[model samples]
Target chain A: DVKVTQSSRYLVKRTGEKVFLECVQDMDHENMFWYRQDPGLGLRLIYFSYDVKMKEKGDIPEGYSVSREKKERFSLILESASTNQTSMYLCASSLSYGNTIYFGEGSWLTVV
Target chain B: AQSVTQLDSHVSVSEGTPVLLRCNYSSSYSPSLFWYVQHPNKGLQLLLKYTSAATLVKGINGFEAEFKKSETSFHLTKPSAHMSDAAEYFCVVSTTGGGNKLTFGTGTQLKVEL
Candidate 1:
């Protein structure tokens, strides 16, 4: 079974704080992604990396960045957190471009 | 440009009743469609996928979907609804040449009644 593990299941941060959300996939998938899920808006892509050190901005990449340092690990960064950035962050990885993907349990971040 | 649309934001059904969640899509090329379910406070789970192989796709939890290229739709259905079926469902599309990118629908909240 493929497993995507998120480092933090819940987090609370004050406005203007830098937040980091880490994700590790045991499957060693090549493609990784960061998505922010909000009510009514659904899951919007934030960024995706096809390989280590390579990233592409997705539909909703503003105020967010991502890093893929290893084959099995991807990280999402919130440079400066704000109340609007409070939402559930999901990390996903796929075997290849457009192939079936797996999602982490999700990191719920709350900005005060 | 490719996009996915989930027709209803919310659908209510009773247990043992039929379930239908409609989704429509527009893509520049032959698309890969998927239906994902998310329980409250949980991550998204892939319910089923249409990869152009079969028009009718059966998925986990006794759910299924049918792809209609003519209408550009991939609608999810279940013969019976269970209380456990209550969740937020999303429709996603991956265009042939769109790389690994997936366009997601706004989402539909399925409420199963007793």
Candidate 2:
């Protein structure tokens, strides 16, 4: 089975602290995505990478940035974590356009 | 552009009764629709998908959804509700020619009463 592994399951950080969430997929898919899920707001895309060195901004890319140094790994970086950034973050990967996508278990982060 | 809307915030049904979860979507062109289920603290799983082939799509765990173009809806249903079926279901929309960006709805929480 294809697997998408998230590095952190839970994390607590102080306000203004830099945070990083890492994801790795074994399927070798070209598309990788980062989304933050919140109550009533649902899952909002933060960023996505379509190639090894390419990245694109999604609808809710306000304070988030992404790095796709390699094809199998994608990382989400929060320059300065804030209280409002506390939410469940999800990582996903897909083969191509409109194909079935797979997700990681998700990382819950809390900024105080 | 494409977007999705899950009609209910929550739905409750008896264990042996039928289950229904409503969804609606809009797009500039023909869109690929999907239903995903997320259990507590787990990753989202694909329940079913509609890629313009069949109007009715069947998924795992006895879940099925029908695509109605006239109503612009893809509603999920199950013949019998099981306690393990309790989870949050999301309606999603994507396009074949539009870079495959996924747009998800707020989700509907299904509660099974035994």
DockQ of each: 0.72, 0.84
Top-lDDT candidate index:
2
Model 2, position B70, has a per-residue lDDT of 94
C-alpha RMSD by candidate, in order: 0.9, 0.9
lDDT of 2 by residue, A14-87 (tens): 99999999999999899999999998988999999889989989988988888999999999999999999999
lDDT by residue (B37-103, candidate 1, tens digit) is 9998888899999898989999999999999999999999999999999999999999757767998
Q: Estimate each model's TM-score.
A: 0.98, 0.98
Per-model lDDT: 0.92, 0.94
Look at candidate 1 and tell me the lDDT of residue A48: 95
Q: Model 1 chain A — which ten-residue stretch has the worst lDDT?
A: A96-105
lDDT of 1 at A14: 99
CA lDDT, candidate 1, residue B4:
90
Tens-digit lDDT track of model 1 for A15-53 = 999999999999878899999998899889999999999
